[model samples]
Target chain A: MDLRDKYGLLIDDMADMRATVRIQLADGGLEKCDQARNVKEAVQKLSLRRYDLIVCDYNLGQGADGQQLLELLRRRQILPLTTAFLIITGETSYEQVATAAEYAPDDYLLKPFTADALRTRLTRILEKKEALAPLYRHLGPKGDPVQALAVCDELLAQGSRYSLDILRHKGELLQTLNRSQEALALYEGVLQQRATPWATVGKARVLAAGGDDTAAKEQLAGALKAYPNYLAAYDSLAAILEKTDTEAAQAVMEQSLAVAPTTQRQRRVGALALENEDYVRAEEAFKRAVEKDRTGFFKSHDDYAGLARSYSAQGKVQEALATVKDMSQYFAASPALTARQAAVESQVYAKAGNAEAAKAALQKALQTRQGGDLDPATQLEIAQACFTSGSAEQAKDIIRNLAEDHHENDQVLAEAQKVFARAGLGDEGGVFLDATRKRMVKLNNDAVALAKAGELDQAIAMLTEAADRLRNNCQVAINAALALLMNIHRKGMDTSALARAHHYILQARHANPEHPRLEEVASFYRKVAPPGTLILDDE
Target chain B: MDTLLATVIHDAKNGLATLGAWLEQARAQTPSPALEEACRQAQRINTQLVELLALHRGSEGTLRLAIADHDLADFVDDLKAEWLAPPQSTITVSWPADAGRIGAWAFDAYQVKLVLLDVLRNALRHARTTVALRLAVEPGGGIRFTVQDDGPGFPVAHSATMHDQGSGLGLSFARLIAREHRTPNGKHGDIEMKNAPQGGALFSLILP
Candidate 1:
């Protein structure tokens, strides 16, 4: 709700809206209308009463804007499909956002519209919605997907007037279900009719999902060239760029942010710019991310940490330290996150001329590290801090732990090597790293031997222990997951064993999202679980 | 300069909305012709403001169309309901039954309404008794809208290009918008103004 003291325009706008709506309803022999001045009041009224139409002004002075409010309602399914939302905007810029948004209002009305214009638009939209009701029943915001597809086929069979609308909905639902080929055919049907940006972008997305990146990129380029402000096109295009070209990905991410500064998109922009070592842009983007995420929907503690890292990259040690403190205020202290924060503090202190403070911060980080299985990323972070603070011996232990667990990850191994090289222990590091790798290999092989001997429970126990030790090591974690899967197969799908398999798969998937072994694990999951069951990675 | 003009127009439009609301309240309470007239004038002010804003946007290239297929008969009836008040002036809309059963056509409904509303308001202002609007689908899939008033025709010696100083801007705005309503095939709409042989100002818009 708005806390703004200036209520003049708001009061006037409410009066106008009420009068116009009241009269229009009166003409149609209907009554019982109320006008709300802010988002909170509107939401409350909406919940308590069933209204056929809402003429919401885009700007609500503060808190959520009308688009955000509409998004929240639609996502939460608080607004029924029959409730027509007509967004009213004072500036044309809102149209860009409306066009870009995935869940837009029924229509947009420019401000200073007469009561007659409002009536005309309201009447037309109601009629249109009435005409599209059958499709809405099958494929609206809270529609049943299977029924929606069935209805789409039925509508197509009957040559329904809303054939194009149903076609787009069926395409999107099919895309969501990973049925890219069928979705592609539908999108192609739309493209045959018109070069609409949504259809163009959908074709690109389907192609990308089908692993035809070259064609996908060309389709995306066409979509972007046709409609520069197509937000989803920019995002899908950026995801493609992320795999092959970081700089271009940064550009596409920036363009998307220009249209809608979603926290997730801004975070991606910050991360991609940081990958390019564009520290200034990274800092700006992270700042925007942190600011926009203040009310916290898709926000996380990492956004603040990202800003601190950007500050540390720029040698703004004081700012970095303050940012970590700010992070503490937002996220409650936890053992693992406390260690990560201390590690960040250590990095900031090491950048300044405070060796003693840096050493103390390392002590704080290590004290927390004693409590839990530190993920390889946290280990690497703490190790970097240790090396920066003149404690190479302490840093070597964390690096060795990471190198042992992550030996199969080229990206992690390279990053670890750089840490060792920077600390002037390049020659000594190879011996330590090799010893750790050999030990981890032996441990893995011993578990396999136990399994081969039909000591399945022993094998599961050994891998469970290894999982705690390796934590964020994808290969080792996947092996642990495999052991659990074997137990599920031997024990006839016991609930406890299934839960363990599910847990390890989540950590493994998060550690390396695109792990090649995912196909193998997915096959095992299919054998052990029901068909159509959602897994962590799939979700 | 444009910004200042827009701000003034915005304020005027908003003020008219408020006045319209107050007039509606007054009419609901007392049901007087004077309050009804006030409401009508407020609506007229809003319509004029809208035309002026469109004229401004036309100067820039920012006035985008919101195209949709509208039933020609339904649209004409709605337009009549919107403009015609009781007993002051009468408006009648008709279409030929021989026009190949025209169901619907794609056009910017709001823009078309604004353009035609300006013409109808001008006709209402001058007509002695009745103004008529007719819709006809041309043989080539184009549509024609004709608005004629049974008022004193355009001053006898008035040239076509020279708009009457009073109704000049509204008619000009209507012409600008009619031309803007081009079909997807790139065929443009056209506007014509004349003094009908029956002695009244006639305006027609043809869209392809």
Candidate 2:
């Protein structure tokens, strides 16, 4: 709780306000303080050095606010859990800061607060952070949730003052580790004690993860009614509804936007509206997503792509092409952007009845892909272009490969289905994607069964080939590593097999760091590997 | 018209806040009773502007409370820190000792704090020597905050309306904010005002 040793960062656009706050912070016993005037400087300072506390003004004066900066830092993992972030805002922006869906600051102080008030908030947040430091040590991007769970148990047993916070983190960790039943119980127990929005949404998420979508939807609906400002409930409900009812999902997203108009939510609403074929609404939402952030840091390629498609759908092909051109100017040159622009151009041209020009653009997009792998979004855009340019087989091949590579990624698979839907093949796309999913699941099951039946050599041969080809398929990589480890356990330790197992485990981790089976495979490696070998620690 | 009113109130409130910050800085550099009073008045105007904006939103049916979990002890501590005693006065304020035991409750801390501060300031003006703020769990569920002063009770004729009080806007704003803190099970918070058996006015804000 001593502020003398803590390092603080003060961010504000106004020089006078910064000086005033700097004096107040000094009055609060914080001597080692740094200042940043904008998001760029703030991020630069944060990346270079770690601070114990950050006090940021809400209005940063450049189309960037503290909330957006916090989101960026949190998403990029530049801000650690140990650092306390506080937002200073006027009454006008308090609701926006309060209703932040994700990446909320530790606390916020309204403007016109005195030095004592500021110190009290800083002290309280610092004290809580100190209490939960042990758990946070293992809760970073590269940290181990398995070990973090152990810390949670220890803290709970000791009756820590932050029991509710610890419980929240524990439930999230349980869900991440795929322990749905236990997570369900934890949430239910918390709900019985008192009604909390997070507990309600957490229970619904567990139900959804366990494939009880009906119950999950019902729970989320009730939670939303109770806590209308709870953005997480709206997000979860919209995600569940997206698969069954795009219109309803779009409505839910609109309600959330009414509560808090985040650019990410705008993109989501645009995507859902596009799926619902409400082209005008899609264009408006995507336009907001593109133009709201004049800083150009938060806008993604998907925003422009969504805007272009919405325009094309409404027979505004010229506007769509113009939007694509603006996208290239907004962002620096990159292969992904080139591929995305060309692919979207193909779709626009096809919609305009220029089949020859569409085919030429599709060839350009395909040539760009030959240089290297693009992001999944760009790849799916190319697949959609393929379908529009009279290349059905090529489109199917592209989607099939992507589906196999990201077999366990629901978001990517959903994007693939959207591509098909845009291509006027919704029903066929669902069936085709379902088959690809089943095929991938069966491949893993058969390999595991063969290994269990003592056909280790056959399992190894089957799994390694699949794992090597589908590098992004986490399940395949995990199984391949498991088979090789099992072989070494039955036979003597073959150095080559051990090395390959290590490689596959690391590959699996790279594919999905939070995969439930990762820790299990890692522990298995630690147990079977010889001493003095280079062991991969779960840092 | 509503948008214009809200925008003007917001800008005025922000201007007052900056003025208050400057006053505070000046007071810190060169302490004086006049600077201190100016700072307090600036803060008072800022709070009133905030209340007016909330009232505007309430009338327009756009008043949304950003309710979330807040530790009761920290909330009380913050209130105590901000509740400055009137200049040249000797009235003292006391808070509940059991706030730490209550843990956290879900409410809009910013708005609730303003409501309580308004009530506390009013009580300070009317109290003879002391004001007390108490916190306890409501009978069925939820939490209650009570602010009572030791002075002449509310006038018998205006006990219900309290129109003799300044503007009567604070009471209405308090009631609106209380009613907004509702639960999923069709339960809503309420505000109650009555003369305490001991001496003075007693106000209870219950949140579910």
Candidate 3:
């Protein structure tokens, strides 16, 4: 309960408020506290050294707030799970501070609190954090969820006072590990005792993951009615509805936006509205997302691209072109920005019947292809532009390559399908994407079969070629590494093969760190390679 | 109009909270009865402003509760910390022992804590020697919080019409919050006030 040893950070824009809270923090026995006047300084301080606690004022005087700061830190993994974050807010902003569903602070205090109250809250949160340290040690960005689940079991068996908190983590880990039935049972057990919002939304998530979309939708609908401020339910419902009904999904996103108009949620609504051909709504959503944050930390290239495309769909060619131009000014110079802007410009010009200019922009976008992989969205934009410029063959080539590289990723494949749909080839796009996915699957299966039949060399050759071509495909890279390791296991270590295996393992980790099979493959390399071989970064 | 009213009330509430904190600091440094009374009054006004703003939002149909799971023991400890005993009174407050055993429940902790604090303060005014708060699982479903004080029970007329009580705003706000807590099965929370069989006033807030 002692705060004397804990390092703390206090963030507030007002110097007076910062001084007041500093005195309070010292009075509360926390002497080693740093001060940050703004979000930029806070991020810098966090990157330099770790803190045991952070007390941030909700109103940071710019477009940024504590909630956004928390989201930024969490998304970038700049803040570890061990650090306790507490938000201080006035009554006017407490609802917003309280209902921050994802990346919520460890605790929040209403402003005007005495030092005694502050110390009490700090002690309570730190005690809970200390009790759950073992579970959290395996929970965040680099932690193993499998090990975290085991820790949850141990704590639960010991009758930990924070059993409810532990159970919440356990259910999420279960879902992440793809154990739907167990997660569903866990949620149901909690619900039998009380109708908690997390358990209600969690049960719906399990239903959705289990592919019972109807039941999931019904559960989410009921949950929203009871807990209308629950953002997670809206997000889950929209994700499920997006596959079958874009219009309904857009509605859900709009409702969530009404509750909390976060730039991320606004971008999601814009994208969904664009898909549903609600061009005006899309334009509004995207405009809000782009203009809401003057700091430019939360705005993404996707928002400007979405805004421009929506303008183009509504035949506002000048406005669309202006938005595309403005996007480059907001973001730093990068190949992704170059590709996204040019591709969006091509779409706008093509819509306005300027074929020559459209083709020129499309060529410029394609030139960025040699600079290495553009993001999936930018690539999709380029393909859509290609389809608009009377190059169906070129467009299909782009989609095919993307599909093969990310065959396991349904989200990317769905985006590819949307590109085809926008090109007036919905059914044909579905069939084409399906065939490409099947081909990628067959390639992996054939290589694995060869390896099993004692043809390690052939398997290695096939998988290595595919993995080399599809650098972003973690599955192929993992299989390639496994094949190399298996060969070394059978024929003893060849340094060349060992080096290639190490390369593919690192490539797979870079592509997708949380791939379920990543640990197994990495451990295999560790076992087969001789001592003092290449060390895995994760280890 | 609603936005303007709510904003003004919110600002006033925040100002009063700051005043209360300052008064508390002065009381701690100087140790005066007058500063103690000023702190109590400042907190009262702050609580009233919070209630008024919430009522304004309720009338505008914009009131939404941020219901989440909160550990009962932590919540009770928070309430105990925030509760300011009446000036020059020897009355003691008792908290529930089974809060940890009850584990956690879903409710808007901020508003609920305010409601319980108001109820406890009211009980302190009426209690002869002791006031106690207890937690239990409500019959049928949900969680219940009871505030009991060993004082003269509410008169028969006032028991039915709580408006006869001091200001009447606290009870109205408490009722509004309790009813706002609901379940997927269509059950809603409620507030009940009555004379306890043990010759004391008992108030309970049940949340689903």
For each candidate, give its TM-score against the true structure.
Answer: 0.61, 0.94, 0.96
**Which scores better on DockQ, 1 or 3?**
3
User: Scoring model 3 with DockQ, what do you get?
Assistant: 0.69
Residue B18 of candidate 3: its Cα lDDT? 74
Candidate 2 residue-wise lDDT, A452-478, digit = tens: 999999999999999998888899999
Candidate 2 TM-score over all chains jointly? 0.94
TM-score of chain A of each: 0.62, 0.95, 0.97
How displaced is residue B134 in candidate 2, in Å? 1.3
lDDT of 3 by residue, B1-208 (tens): 3599987887787677677778878888999878877877887887888888778787887788888889998899888888777767899999998898889899999999999998998888788999999999976889899999999978777674452256788888999999989887688899998889889899999999
**Candidate 3 local lDDT, A372-414, one digit each (tens):** 9887888998999999998999999998888998998889999
lDDT of 1 at A352: 76
Residue by residue across A82-155, what tens digits does model 1's lDDT show?
A: 66678778634443455456566777776656666666766666665676666677554334556667777887
Give lDDT tens digits, candidate 2, residues B44-104.
7777787888888889977777767778888898888777777788998899988978777
CA displacement after TM-score superposition, residue A36 of candidate 1 (Å): 8.1
Q: How much is B6 displaced in model 2, in angstroms?
A: 1.7
DockQ of each: 0.10, 0.47, 0.69
Off by over 4 Å in 2: A100-102, A210-215, A537-539, B14-39, B163-166
RMSD of each: 9.6, 2.6, 2.1
Ordered by lDDT, highest first, the candidates read: 3, 2, 1
Query: Distance (Å) between predicted and true CA of A388, model 1?
Result: 8.8
| Top-down TM-score ranking | 3, 2, 1
